[model samples]
Target: MRRQAATFVWRAALAAALVCGIGLLPWLTRTDPALTVLKARSADRDPTPEVLADIRAQLGLGDGPLRLLGQWLGGLWRGDAGRSWISGDEVTPAVLQALGASLLLMAVALVVAVVTAGLVCARTLRLGAHRRLDGRRTAGSGSAVLAALPEFLTASVLATVVGVQLGWLPALGWYGPQWTVLPALALGLPAGAVIGRLLDDLLPGAFAEPWALAAAARGLPGRSIARQAVRRCLPGLLPNLGLFVVGLTGGSVAVEQIFDIPGLGRTTLQAALAQDLPVLQAGTLLLVLLAAVAAGLAALATRRIAGPALRDGALSSLHRPQPPTRGIPTFVHGGLLTLVIALGLPRDPLALDTTRRLQPPSWTQPFGTDALGRDMLARVAHGALDTLLLALAIGIVALVAGALLGLVARVSGPLVDTVNAVPPVLAALLVTSVAGSGAATPALAVGVVAWAPLAAHTSALLRQERAALHVTATRGLGAGRWYLLRRELLPAVLPPVTRHALLRLPGIALALASLAFLGLGAQPPSPEWGLLLAENQPYAERAPWAVLAPAAVLALLGALAVSAAGGIRRARPRTSATLAERPSLTRELVETG
Candidate 1:
């Protein structure tokens, strides 16, 4: 018990230290925080050396990294989170206030997601086996579509349809209980899709179990049997729920900004823009802590409900060998690609029509005109090409580079591990610093960061495959290294790599959009989905169509990608038996009822 306590303490300390280190990232960058803050607040006014020195002193710039960290930690221990650089207000009070709003939003979203997932699961389970399979495909496709769209795009579309177009809700502002509905729906739909899909995957195996058969033999209703299956799957689902919450919290940045909600995500984004280090650091620390605590709670709940054996098994499954899930059909992927090209080929996205500025949707302007009088449909269509092309390029580059690196790492394990230890965001920032921002910058940043995981997975797989009996037999036949790799290893690796690439597409798109939203990706007038969201946000009230059109396009593309990937996975042959291998339950329950 003492040893376990010590281990827990060490882990907690390490997590805290890692979060603190991340909080120091803004300071570690080359840009001067004091200068940025001064420039943002003062506008055209130049800060002389004396004024700059004073500002630096005020920000504790004279201290080294260690000293600053120590001081910050000390203050934190005393219940002080320092002060905001922009307003000079206490960080704790502001953070707490913002946190309350964010939590409220999150709670609503969670309830919606859970209820929606439950209904979908219950409805799907009622069908006959053949009908269930068809239902599963349709549900999978719908979930994939929802999962593909980013939060900002979803929020914009919801706001436009329900709030602006139909007068059911206000377009913007967080006034009362009614205001939470749209944002919660926006957040809930994607999360619900994720949960629904997870349940879909788990239910089949559970339904195949002995217990399910026994329950059926006893003449219990399908719903009762389904409830038992759901309970059995809950242990697996809880950890994913925690991760979804963490992701939702992070994704709330764009959602909060679009809805004009004063949540911590919006506050952090504002601080990032202004380079308000104090507020940014505090916000980062708070978010990191929240994620860690939430994850820990999930683990505890899993252990309590499912016992230590199942909990440990679930945790260990991370390192276990797994089958490659197939991706969408090749013809479908090709068709989508062709469609994007056709949309972008003819129309000039940048051509202005000053006479039709901010026009509503009509026959003349299908998606209407933006504030700048650019045709929204043409720009969105063109933007699809840009977004898809960038994401594909990043995926190809990351895959190829990771494969080569994985080969090298098989020989130099320690060196690869050291390089892999560097945070992807830091690597991205360093690359951006050297490459400078442009059309290629976002891809470069995201690719460099994304390659590490692929490389690690590949390296591990290669290590396992290299020791297989077939490799030994090939060696006995005097097969060379290149020949063995080409004939044996490459074939084994390609399927998983392909699936990983497909799974990675949506993430790459979101990353590109995020960077573009942050002004580090595609610049204005480019029609990139993220850029459109950022640029057209201000005119959301007057020209709702401009924002909604691009958002819809983004969501549509994302859905296509997700659905395609999911279709491929579903097409793969099933390998594992359902409930036969699960840990047995208590004998009392088995014998009693």
Candidate 2:
């Protein structure tokens, strides 16, 4: 009871901190909310000091940030979210409406993601049971491809190809059930791929268990065994399932924008951009609440799924542990893409010719030109350096931070889970609101959540590794905590954490691009991949190449990262559980007997 109370207090504190931060964003950023509100209310009107004073007084901001936060909190307790500075309407209703839309979208997207993950896992298991040499290999490749593709790029391609070209689904708007399809898929597929890959990785060990062997010996079907294996993998995957839910709901800003959906992501982004403090605060508060709720539910679900065995430590092995992957294919694919981009980079990226604007791909301009007549090939080539470097830096930072923090998992677990729930886009929104959007904003925003996954992975692995007999023996010999952590733990933890970080590099780049696409990252004429996609989107109908070129490149980068991290062969850890080396029939007989 005390532990639960402490956890609740921590979550509440974090949520309050987030709300206060949002409320005070203007002041923190050195921007006067009165002026911002005045400008938003009447852009044409000159804001004299007297007028600013009047506006500040009207909004109850003359008392400073502390008083403002107190007033907002007081109002919030009374169910009054205040009024929007821009629309002059009640913030509560608008926030609620947006929340409803976002919830519905998140629910649908969650279903799609789960279904996609299920199908992928089923196929892999079926093939593996059949002794197909390519079971993991095939699934790994497909999942890597899907996981590497960024949400914004996926939304754009789906919008353009499926919604526009194929005329199958509505590419724009949020009116009916039909409108949800493309957006849900865009949000779900890549997420599903990630979840599916992790689940697939966990299944092999489950299949090699004595119970599984006994079941097979007792004439249980492959399908039933696979089902049990999935159930075993569930405890490991559920925590991340909560994270994904939060991500789908929170990080969906770009998708909502692309589809013109009036969800919380878009609403919060709009409020942030307009400096609508009331609406922004309400929206942010609600998101933080959602995170708290999601975390609680996930914990409940984990407990339920794990049952009493979890408390007894009987199911400890089912918890997260790194599955090593290979990288040759990743390099080959990445190199090919790089070579292709390099081959057509003779032209200056910044040099423009109006006559050549939106030109089709040709021998001279391999990837064609954008709206401004800047050579796409040259732009992509130049942008690669900036994008890749930033991603690498972010990955390294996340890895180091996660590793150190993960060592104190008991203390940091709640914090990690809570922060992990804040989507990169939402983080970008908050950061951009205070710091203003720039190249660094995306890095800071993405860095906030990127560390959580690695941290969680490390925490789980640390828990698993500490149970080793060698660690216990060393500790019995009077090895201090520091020595155990340094000589014993660090060596085991760093490699897997590094590998997890590698898998996440493409995602970091994609997230940066997504922010760029949403006007929260690199600005105009920058040619950063996401920015390029954003700039070219308006011209997608007239010149499809403008969009496809960058999208294709981003997709390739994703594939490279995923494959590099995953590798050609499953590199299960030496300590990982597996059936003893013996004939399958003999093992089955022994287990059954």
Candidate 3:
């Protein structure tokens, strides 16, 4: 009961902090709330002092943040979310309507994701069981590539080829069930690929367990064993699934914009940009609450799925890090070959020739020309250098920050969950709201949330490592915390965590590009990849290459990173008494006592 009370207290604290942060946003950004509200209400009028005073009084901007936050909280308690600054309508109805649409879209997308993950996992297991090593590797390569594709890029291609050219599905608007398919696919496929990959990595270890051996010896069918193996993997996956669900509620900003779906993500982003305090506060509150609730529910589901094993610590091993596979996948070689050709090309990205605008690809202009007649090949090549260097720098910084916080400081899990709940798009909006967009705005935004996953992973690994027999023995020998951390803990944790961070690089790059595409990053006339996609989107039909060039290069970069990270093989420790050599009794003793 006390533990549950503490949990409730922290969750409530997180919610209050989010609301307070929203209320304090104007002041933090150095903008006058009265002026912002006045402009939203009457943009044509000058901001005279008397009019500003009236608007301030009307919006209660004169009150301190604490008082305003308290009033907002009190109003929320009474089921009133206040009135919007832009529309002047009650906040509850509009937020609820948008929330409902988001929920429906999430539900459909979840269904699609579940099916795709199930199929991929099943195929992997089936192939592994048959000892088809080549087939398993090939199948995994495709999904890894698919997982690398960003939602915005995926949506753009699907909308153009399937909706516009083929005329099979509606590309834009939120009208009926038919409109949901494209957006759902855009979100679901990559999510499914990630889930599938995690599960595939877990299954091999589960099948190798003694329980599976006993089940097979007892004449249980292969299907039954596979089912049991899958069940064991679920406890480890549920939390991540919950995280994805929470992220989808706000991270689908790009998809919502592309499809013109008036979901919560789109609505909240619009409100943030327009400085609609009432709606922004409500939406932010709902998202934060959804994250907390989803986390609580995911924990409950994990306990239920884990069953009696929860007490015995049998299923705990399922959550530990697995040794990553080494050797570059065949797909990476293909990406490298393309890179070689791109490097050898000769063209000036800034050379503008109006007569050759939108020229098709030929022996001379390999990737064709853009609207301004600049060489697409040259632009893509140049963009790659800037995009890649920035992404690598950000990835390294994020990895270090996450490592220190997770492994050294050991930050609170609730704090990590709460912060991670804010998606990159929303974070970007928040930073943009304060800093005003610049080259570093998207980087700052991405940096804010990028460290969460690494922290979570390292924390989990730390917990597992702390229970190892060697750790217990070293502690018994009077080893201090720093000694253990330096000699044992860091060594064990850093390698797998590094691999995990490597897998995240492509995602970080994609996120940076997503922000750029949304006009929150690089400005006009920049050869940034996402900016290129944004510029060429309108001419997608007339000159598809303009869009496809940058998109394809981005896709290739993602695929290469995924393949390289997936190929990494952790080296074995040069110790006579390895962890694997330690008795099971020693581990059990350390865990239980």
Candidate 4:
């Protein structure tokens, strides 16, 4: 235990160190520029070599990269990220202000998502009889509604209907409580979509377990099974939660900008536009740190909650018990997988009637097309391919990168908090102006920015798997790392990991799709979901369903994904027959009549 704790600490330290180095990359490159610019101006001010010498010496520009880095580190250690050259104010306070808002919004949004997702997932997990049952699909559809709904279109609709039409709340960020609703809903919907899917998975497993059955045979009521089984299944849910949070934090940048919220995300947009050096570095660093912390928490949660092979062992024990019982696994398992797979099959909703543009849902188009006369169904089907491919692609790349880096930290000792501290996404967003309004770029952009989540979850899973009993037994069997990991470690972790990877699609889809809708995504004629909605947003008030149709389809796709991912596994949860085999049959009584 002591060794393990130490290892964790050492790895964490190493991650921090890497983050710090990466975070300061911008500052390192700017040192020469700072000197050159200052030195150039110095010639105009003074003819004397001594004056130039004094100017160069004062700013520490003559120093090498290492020397300058050391000096910068020294300043950083003292909690000064430096003053904003553009704003002329201390950079730290402005940053704190932005971070506070972002955190607050995230906190609020997450809470809403947690509740909404929990309820949606719980319905499928706790209440539903089997994975394919219509109840679970209803819950899935709810998530679909959330996921398929475009943020801009949703936000715009919310802005128009709730904010403008209804006159209930502020459209833009008023820095008050009421203003949070629209943005929170916009953000919360996709997150809920993920959570619902997770719950869908976790619940059915709980429902189909032998322990649940065992408890039931012992006169444990259905409610108790729901309660205890859910509790047990919850540990399995953490990894997904972590990934969702990681994605949310990373994705929040675009959302914040669209909503016009007074958070670091909104400020990040400003930083990118102005190319404000200090603002960019500090801002991106903050984003990186937030992402790292979220990832670390996810790792820690996986360790503390999952505890390696215990979960797999418990699940295995339930599935293949010592006692004989009629197999209840077939329908429940198959049905659930079928239901979840159904979601992956794309649906097209494009319509061709140009006569009545922007019409609501009708017999011709169940989900009415947008102003463009494309079928809502067809567009949604096409959009699914777009989002899934893009988000999954990015997640895969990040997974590879983060896993390798995390392994490096685990095996070797370094300051992890620092390495994990560097803000790659924030830095990129700050440095790069989102070029090309092409459909591909936004997805590409979202993927590039969200690399951390892939890394965090994959590495965390690897470390957690390393501690599983199977791995331990493999070690006991004198098996080498290759024999152990490839055969043992990878299999146990891969299922859940794959489940989560699939679950990520909806959220990534929503984020990328949302980006397109905001005009930061695909250019004209691209026909992506977000772009389509953004194009039709003008007719929102008069022809609401035209936009609503595509939105519904998108939401449904998200829902189908959650349903399918969650519904992948099912078993008839019966009480433990290991102790009381055929309790009723064994205790057969003569008819007293």
How many clashes in each candidate? 4, 2, 0, 56
- Predicted candidate 4: what Cα RMSD to the true structure? 10.0
> Could you give candidate 1's per-residue lDDT for residues 499-576 as a string of tens digits?
455556666787688777766778878888778877777788888787777656555555565545444332221212
Q: lDDT for every model?
A: 0.64, 0.76, 0.75, 0.55
Ten contiguous residues with the weakest lDDT in model 4: 317-326
Which whole-number lDDT from 0 to 100 does residue 153 have in model 3? 77
For 20-77, candidate 4 gives per-residue lDDT tens digits of 5543544544433343334334435544566556644654546744665565456767
| TM-score list, all predictions | 0.72, 0.88, 0.88, 0.67
Model 3 per-residue lDDT tens digits across residues 1-593? 98777777887787778778888898888888888777777889999999999878877778866787688778998889999877789999999999988888888888888888887687757754443423212335566667767788789888888998898999999999999999999999888877776677567656666687688778777787778888876765675677778767778999999999999988898888778888999998888878878777877886687645554433333323345555555356455636734763455678899999999988888789999999888888877777878888989998898888886422355666777667788788889888887888889999998887777666655655565555666566566677667666677677656756776777787888888889888887778887888888888889999988876776666566656665554344332254467656345434433
Q: Please state the error at residue 494 of candidate 1 in Å.
A: 12
RMSD for all candidates, in order, please. Answer: 9.3, 5.8, 4.1, 10.0
Off by over 4 Å in 3: 1-4, 48-51, 130-139, 164-167, 307-310, 315-346, 407-410, 460-496, 574-593
The residue ranges of model 2 lying beyond 4 angstroms of the native Cα positions read 128-138, 164-167, 316-328, 344-346, 433-438, 461-496, 567-593
lDDT of 3 at 424: 81
Give residue 256's lDDT in candidate 2 (0 to 100): 95
Q: 1 or 4: which has the higher TM-score?
A: 1
Q: How would the candidate models be sorted by lDDT, starting from the highest? A: 2, 3, 1, 4
